[model samples]
Target: MKKLNYLLIAIFTLGLATSCDSSDPAIIDEDDNQSGTTITKAGLITANETWTADNIYVLSGKVVVNEGVTLTIEPGTIIKGAEGQGSLASALVIDQGGKIMAEGTADKPIIFTSVLDNITVGQKKGSNLTIANVGLWGGVIVLGKAPISVSGDLETKQIEGIPATDSFGQYGGSIANDNSGVLKYISIRHGGITIGSDNEINGLTLGGVGSGTTIDHIEVVANQDDAIEWFGGTVNVTNVVTYAQGDDAIDADEAWSGTLDNALVIMGADSDSALELDGPAGSAATEAGYTIKNVTLKGAGASSVSKYADLRDGLIANLQNILAYDFGPTSVVKVNGADSATELAAGRITFLKWEIVLPAGVTSVSSLITGANAGDDTKFTNNATAITAASAATVGANTAVFSWTYAKSVSAF
Candidate 1:
């Protein structure tokens, strides 16, 4: 009887220790995905939070910063996305009314990549992935309350690659100066995961993002879709470098009335164009046009470039001081049909000071631009002037500003 009482007393003492412990419930059998510290962000972030540089964050699936909340990321922080497809795809979404201050200095740019990457803390590049790797995960998405010219002149539209049933997918409002937050010195790589059939997200998607947002010194590498695509809104961007994208390097849609300055586009063979500019789909913001200047568009050698640029959908643009090189003879910048050519003549799509190193045996700079309409042959170039022959290095984007980019480290340019 005395020995049994002693056993009960020992069990009662152990119960007190167990009730006081504060760690997470013990796992039956599990190993940490990564060494040191890893925090998995899943579902929605409902409160203001900060992700410090000391910890690595993993996006489990469809992580969102909910409305009216702010999520700040420290410089040199590394965020990775888990691999999945369809609705299960992982991405960092700053939804409408939410904000993210992802501010990184050039010396310590915030890196967003796939969890499969072998990169660890205090590292910029992983050993396993290369410039050719792509579509490993979904990319970063920023949605804000800004004007968008959608079909039927709707004030809002559902963002692409997201289900319509999701209320968080809606973007656009009347606020032209709406502030989404800041994204600077950020590098997004090996993303563009497919969320649906033939629908892969862009490396950096700005949907109805307003001018109050700050975007600069950004780099996007090896995305399966467009590196950066603006679906309306008036966000001015600066010093952007996109390399090895499977689609257009820069795409503007739905009356994006903003300027893209000092941009560099290193195109891949699967890319449709280096710059794909689209016009308004609705009557609203019909007069709004985009300005693209000081851009350098490079193509893969041989017959790999389908076209230098695709200017269609009645886009209004002021394209000046641009350079393109390393393209094949068949490649040309096209203006769709004659109505678009007439629109070009009316200054809806203006071109100036284009310096192109013509393909081997191809000499005329005007020959590099084409009009698809049988009657509009050569008329598109006739309306424009200052298409000259020159070396790309003499003008166009100052590549030195993009030295902090991962594409530069990999010599992708």
Candidate 2:
């Protein structure tokens, strides 16, 4: 393992020196050239390693941190993913028992962008890729030995965007507080490659990640699929922002028993729902609902015709202090299916202190859910106790934290 690490470092240093000598005339001295390592990486990380900010790491294909290995990335580090589709898609996968201590400060956030981006090692923004460039590559996938619920009540299941034959793609276990690692102040952009029909990678995929993992200040922009999706995990998140995603911004499925605090979702013109929540496929004791608070969801316009949220699949949710606005003429909140409506009626799923701004001609929240043409609002009668209307918008994620993100630079905030 030690030899492998040395070899990797040597290779990285050699690549950096070569690139700097050939491409960058500004780097004239050997001292500046020795400051960082550059690696075009793929395959498995068998041992613990730390990636410094001075270095640039590029992912050419699917890279996995095997079980019992640790991958630590310093603040301001820029990782790039190559472009591909189907079997050739690229990503960084932290397998079960693997740990990634990627904690960056607000001033120096870590970045994971596409290889097509012209970002340098020390700079935050690239000259090439913008928020409009979407689905350029794959994204991050973290798996842990946490509890999940599958159709057959299986303890584990394979995640999407990866081949089923790869057993390392599987996640789930009995431990609710199982620790994966820490992720803070990270930005992922221009990702979400389609591996198959209706099977595309999310900007950030948390599959059975446990509560012990610390995740905060995450931003995903212009992803082809969901910005972030939790697949039956107890991992809580805070200060998250998703912008211009093609699919749902924040999607919680498989009965993710987590908490989302201070999240902002901004839909693009081609985006779908701002939020998509679903429950477990089968009955499992560990599979529980989620709590989301202080969220601001905004769609493109009436031309987009997307919903603020679709709560379905018999999932229990506690939504509080949410401000939903700028959506099209679609339903603001749809209690999907009969089972979900029953859950909403029983107070298992609740929404409190929501400030909504519907499109033109939409009179009431009742009309939005039941369709303006529908005669009655009886379907949402169960949610009457907890769901209420507010005139002024008061709930949303803090815009201050997004100052370092591209969303802020482009004034999307």
The lDDT for every candidate, in the order shown, is 0.81, 0.80
Which residue pairs in candidate 1 collide?
none
* Residues 15-39 of candidate 1: C-alpha lDDT, one tens digit per residue: 6435553211111111223443566
Off by over 4 Å in 2: 1-37, 285-288, 371-391
- Give the Cα error of residue 383 in candidate 1, in Å: 9.3
Which 10-residue window of candidate 1 scores lowest in summed lDDT? 22-31
Give the Å error, residue 334, model 1: 0.9
lDDT tens digits, residues 1-413, model 2? 75467576666655654665221212111122343555666667777888889877887678888899899999999988987887678899999999999998878999999978888877878877766799888999999888887789899988888888765688998888999899999999999988777577999999999999999999999998899999997999999999999889999888789899998888898887888888777787332369999898877977877777788788888887778777777646777787777676666777776667756677666655632113223434333222233235566666666787878878886
Q: In lDDT terms, which candidate is top?
A: 1
TM-score of each: 0.88, 0.87
The 10 consecutive residues of candidate 2 with the worst lDDT sum are 22-31
